[model samples]
Target chain A: MKFDDLKKLHQKKYRQQFGHFLVEGEHLVLELQRALTRGTLASGSVTLYVSERYANFASPFEKVLLNDRQMSQLSDTKSPQGIVALVPLPEAPTTIQPAGKAIYLWQVQDPGNLGTILRTLAWFGGFRCLLSPGSVDPYNPKVVRASMGAIFHVPLELDVPLAALPDRFARIGCLDLHGESVVADNFVAQDCFVFGNEAQGVPREALSAMGASAFTIAGQGAIESLNLASAVNICAYEIQRAQG
Target chain B: MKFDDLKKLHQKKYRQQFGHFLVEGEHLVLELQRALTRGTLASGSVTLYVSERYANFASPFEKVLLNDRQMSQLSDTKSPQGIVALVPLPEAPTTIQPAGKAIYLWQVQDPGNLGTILRTLAWFGGFRCLLSPGSVDPYNPKVVRASMGAIFHVPLELDVPLAALPDRFARIGCLDLHGESVVADNFVAQDCFVFGNEAQGVPREALSAMGASAFTIAGQGAIESLNLASAVNICAYEIQRAQG
Candidate 1:
């Protein structure tokens, strides 16, 4: 296909209408190939798009073919890693399965921060996400880029109200620097760890509803609170370890 | 001052000449107030510069008040938190101290990632940062926003060569997923932990000289590698635990 045709997928409008988005880099290409061979990919597969120059550059993955300019256009990166693919959007899962662990975000504002936390949740491998009403749009381009494709893999629910959260989850915990130390108690249930807005802790109403006080990361105060992603990683790791 | 006069500070030339930049929001204002009261601000000082409407709102800190139009000129935020400060630049430390724990970033491209790592280092509290050539400029506006004022607290040295790094510190370790289990070893280095380019691990020559192979965050198939900031946080915590 022509390079111009590949570049068209960079737009969200095009991606939504066509149900495909671009994936770049040799590593992701290899993953797509492996997932396809293993039948791990969904029924409707992606066209394995690659530039001829990239194909000649010693990649282990077969099926190397696509236009160079098109590959560059489809890629989100400034310095394209020379490979791009038109991958089908995995169907967004709608059901809130009672996953063994969950992290609920309360009005978290920054797209980059939200994206980083999503990527961390996926990295640790055991939690799902529920976004409060005021949170940044998860589909924002910056969020997608920071998530490193984890947005596709992680189970995410948007526009979910904080009020609706308790009925759907087992035990909910909120992360606050001024509250109880996260280390003191054993998190016994399949838990939902809540991280509030970066500037504010969970709202008083959200805290009151959860019934458990806030838990803080014990650290020196060079700053007021932990980065949202760091807080998620620490809380998720502790919860995972406790479950074991 | 006119709002137009303050708004012009967002330009690089104006900021450089004045040696002042704008910080907006309640959190940063409160933190800067604390820093000022404690006399921690050395590079210069903060000019509270708030609008009248914000004055009606209770302020957590003692601030130099300003009118809304005046405050608007000084603010870079679209929706100014009604509070903005012309904060002094943090004093750069002389002589990169061989603090036993340090993270050296080489050519880390993204400003947000760099800022996130800075916040992570500050949260963990023991780690210092060294930026090799080509790393994102720490002063970039995106970095400052993502850092949440961590730029003031985290000690950093920029444009240092990788060749000179091993000699300046004790243990030198590189993050490579294929090398060794990070959990398997007590990464008790009084030296430097080097995180390479986002897409590439440490350079081959730097790898051999660092006296270690690689270390990885244990995870399943979703992530090929943890984000740079996330990896730094996980490893730093592991190192702290191993030492204790």
Candidate 2:
């Protein structure tokens, strides 16, 4: 692929067209390599791009060394690490059935929020992240960066609709302002957990139609909302806490 | 202040120079109004700037009308709500005596993280936030926006030294990767909870010098670290959960 075409992976459309996205920085590239070794990421689907400084870094994947200008063009951040990876968009989960409950994010918009949630889900293990249509692209550089490479570990399913959740999981729970406490007895028993958009939370009628139980974090404050990612992180922790 | 001067609030220095910061959008403007009525904010220190669209909106604060361009200049968002407030920097907390335990943030850098943490602090109530000298400006526009108006309700103290914590809180606690579980019986007994910087975390030496107890959230995952705001948010929820 042309170096010029690789730079285009910064945008979602180009990433889709080229069937790959750019993962920049040494830490994330190392994570990609780890994922490759773990067999979670498909082998032979990654291409390492490094500058002169990392020309000798040992890696199994094919390496392409770029000059300073070429490295800058392929890098997303202002301070380029001079090392990046061209990772293929994760192919559909093969025979390896990823473990755990489902976390359905309903059009959650912030790339940072999605990435942070992925990190949280990855930390707890045994969970897959599902993004609703109209959500920010999970493969966006910002989301991948914010995930701290959790993007390579956690199972992700994009364009999973809010409406499809009911058929997939018999018990679904969601956060609501007036719901029962998340620590309540029934909270952790759900098969799937749904979180809403940052600005407009999940519609009441939609949640009711899906028969999803309501659970609130239970707080005492004059403010009305929590950041989308923060709410998900708390829920993930609660679910893990209850298991022990 | 001149219209030209208001534009300068976009930068942190000018915010300090003018002794005020901007809060944009209708929700936040309403939140500021709520704070004013609740006596959390001083009566005369707020000035609302509105475009013709909100010319008749009712509020006790003095209102200034701005043209579309002026409103755009004042707003940090792409879509102006045609409403913004110039709120005075909170003077050193005087006789009001903010309630509850202290949350000491040591040099938290991201505006969104600091703002989200403030929101979490406000949501849980009974917590006054303390920022170390190098932390992000709590009143920066990005912080204010991300806070979703919690900045008005949460009591904040700035430029606090981390070393001063030892003299103030007799029982101090900080999160560590290998510490006891956060859910332990004694976690709620702390007078102050210290959260570290996003990248470096609280140095072991500093934590040791302060005689702070180490508590971990405890999880099983291959990926390491949580987003700073998410960590603080989870801690706030856990503290509140234990209290009940």
Candidate 3:
């Protein structure tokens, strides 16, 4: 891809149009290669771009050599890591399988929060991320970068409507101030944990539609709420703990 | 304060020199006021600055109205929240009492990570945060902002060397890959949970000095590690869970 076209991958529109997204830094490129080796990703779906300094780095996919200026132009970060990969965007599944773990987000606006949530989900494994319409693009460079390469490992369904969650999962859980304690032995098995926007929490109507049960990570301090990602992390960990 | 001087609060040097820091946004300002009302914060230690738009907002501290431009100048965020507070930095205590919850961060470089950890610590309550010498400044504007006013709620001790931890806490727990599972029944009560830098784990010597016991949050997936803040959150939650 031309540097101009590669740079366009930084934006959501270009990523959607080209059906590809950029992954930078050596760590992520290594992760992409690992996914390919594991047959989790298609072999020819990645195109690696590297500066001359890193041109000799062993990569399984087709490689493009670029100068520092071209590499910098293609990078989303201020200090370019000299390696970028254009990976085909995996098709979002229209229907999700029931019975496994899943996380549903409604209009989560922060890329960092989305990324960290994905990382947590990937760490636990067996969890799919369902993003409601109007959520930040999962393929946004910031999200991809912050995900620490979990973007490749975790399955993501984009533009999922909150109203449709009931059809997809058996139990839907959400965090709320007046919810059941997540640590309670009576906390039901939830296939989907729905998180809301950072500012405005899960809408009441949608919660009722999904028959969502509220769960709270009870704490002693004066904080009004935990950061969205932290809440998800604690919830995911609790699920793992319960299963173990 | 002059605009130039107000702008200087963004830097750690200036904050240290002036013995004060800035808090922005309506939520944090309200939190500051709440802290004052609850007697958690000293009166007359906060100087609120507001744009004409928010001039009528009730605050316990003295308020200075500023123009939009001046408000923007005083704010650290790209979009000024039109409210700012100059808050005096609490004096770091020379010694910490043993037998309560505490978190120790060593060389944690990310301001956001430090901030989120503080927020988590505050939410758990009865927890003090101890920063080893090389960690990011808890008072950095980004840290303070990301803290969501937890900066005011959580007690912090800066520039604490790791070697001094044993003198303060009897049991120091550190997360590790090969350690005892954090969810295990044998997980002991620890006065301090030592978290390491984002990239580097805790220094070997320091961990040894603290007699830090290792604990792992077991996961099935191939993720190399969890985000530092997420790890800390999980640890804090586990501590709360064990106690409850």
Candidate number with greatest DockQ: 3
Instruction: Kindly indicate the candidate among 1 and 2 with the higher DockQ.
Output: 2
Candidate 3 per-residue lDDT, tens place, B15-58, comes to 88888889889988888887876676755768889998898998
Summarize candidate 2's per-residue lDDT along B1-244 as a digit string, tens digits.
Answer: 8889999998989999989889898889999988887888965778899999899999988999999988888889889989999888888887444558888999999998998898888888888899999899898888998898998888888998888888777899998787889889788888789998889788889889878999988877567787888888888988888888
lDDT of each: 0.69, 0.87, 0.83
Which parts of model 2 have CA positions greater than 4 angstroms off?
Answer: A94-98, B95-98
Error of 2 at A57 (Å): 2.6
Report the Cα interface RMSD of each model, rounded to 1 decimal. Answer: 2.1, 1.1, 1.2
lDDT of 3 by residue, A33-90 (tens): 8777766674476888899888899988888898888888898889999998999998
Task: Name the best candidate (by lDDT).
Answer: 2
Residue B101's C-alpha lDDT in candidate 3? 81
TM-score ranking from best candidate downward: 3, 2, 1
Model 1 quality (TM-score): 0.73
Ranking under DockQ, best-scoring first?
3, 2, 1
lDDT of 1 by residue, B142-215 (tens): 67777787776677777888888767765677787765667665456436777887788777776686665466
Q: Candidate 1 at B23: error in angstroms?
A: 5.1
